[model samples]
Target: MPFPPKANGLFYNSLPPESIYNATPTALEQPFTPKMTVCEERQSLRKRYQFPEEPVDRYVAALSEMAPNCAFGPLENEMVRDQPIEGISSEGIRERLLSIPDFTLEKPLTASQQMEIAKKDAALFSIPDLTAAVQSTESTSFSSFRGTGDLLRPTPPCFRCGRASHLASCSNCHAKHARCRKRDKLGHFAQVCGSVKPSSQHEVVHSVSAVCFTDIRRYHIKTQC
Candidate 1:
């Protein structure tokens, strides 16, 4: 009678019950939270924090940012205080911090104090410009000798025969014992030695003396004629 009760609508029967959609969400289905908790995040940051090659002040600023998120309440100060000592990029600074009579792991300096020491050490000690120093050394080593022309005007004469040029066949060099008083050696004559005393005749002497300064030490080098 009423169109056979509308044939019991197949679409309506196929739909899920309303209660299934309204049921409470399981743990997996709940609103998402970060997998890493505050402690874990803080630990991760601590593990990764290291002294950068930049200025110590920059490192201090970066390290300070981690303090707000720290979960280790009382121990946070110690952690911050020791980070620079343990993770410093500079060995000199690390050693300086370690050498402090009052500084120890059990009784570490305050973060600010540690930072102050680090800044002072950074200012006091610097990596020497070795490349520039080396270039300077090379220049000094190869520089022309002073008063060289005045010492030996007409080119140096040979020590054996007092001539401008000496031949192997020269009898004096081979016959006489070549004694070098300046060098205290017997192989060469004193006249050809770099440290030879000036002769009364103002004879031309080929000698070079170089003075070099290194590490607050002086070195003198002499060359023979």
Candidate 2:
């Protein structure tokens, strides 16, 4: 398989390393880290990257306990005044979010339910079911059909075996298999109930019939008819 496209990080990381081991520190080398007042740094950082909504009372209280000399800008003062952070509780939001169902997880379905879904999909795709079609219609004769509007059509020979009458339908030739005496795939007899010898020249015709039946079944499957 071809490699997938990688982001810029891959190219940057693929370069050869320059320095290996650390050398003795020179006079120009920087000190480990100069002593710095965190109070001043925090003040400057707060001024530069301040939240638009701040709880003024709580911040003032916190600052009074630490550093009171820090000056806040007008925007910071306004933000602190307009928003009240005293009553904000993350726990409430968490509880509310937990109440909803997560649809991403797989749902359990029984075998029968899955089968029903498959039948529905097959109907949508025009898959044929000969036995069902035959049984569903009120007609006593085989030629008289029913349920012809949509989502159903005539089944190939294979599907007829699946009907309640046949029990799981023949896979070889939809309804036209050797088992089907009406179609006569074996020439002398239907593959389903044929009594003729398999060595006869008619066997070729039967084989071809079987193949045609299978092809027809496949075609019917394509349309879900």
Q: Number of the top candidate by TM-score?
A: 1
Per-residue lDDT of model 1, residues 68-105, tens digit only: 68776887666666676766666666676776675544
Off by over 4 Å in 2: 1-201
- Badly placed stretches (over 4 Å) of model 1 are 1-36, 95-225
Best by lDDT: 1
Question: Which digits, one per residue and each the tens of the lDDT, describe model 2 over residues 1-225?
Answer: 643467445533444464322322321243455644766744543443213343323434443333323344444443332222222223332233234354111111122234445556766757467656744552333122112211232232222332323322234434433345576343222433333333433455466667655655565454444
Give lDDT: candidate 1, residue 200. Answer: 19
TM-score of each: 0.35, 0.14
Model 2's TM-score against the true structure: 0.14
Q: For all the candidates, what are their Cα RMSDs to the real structure?
A: 15.3, 23.4
Q: After superposition, how far is residue 168 of candidate 2 from its true place, in Å?
A: 33
Per-residue lDDT for 23 in model 1?
39
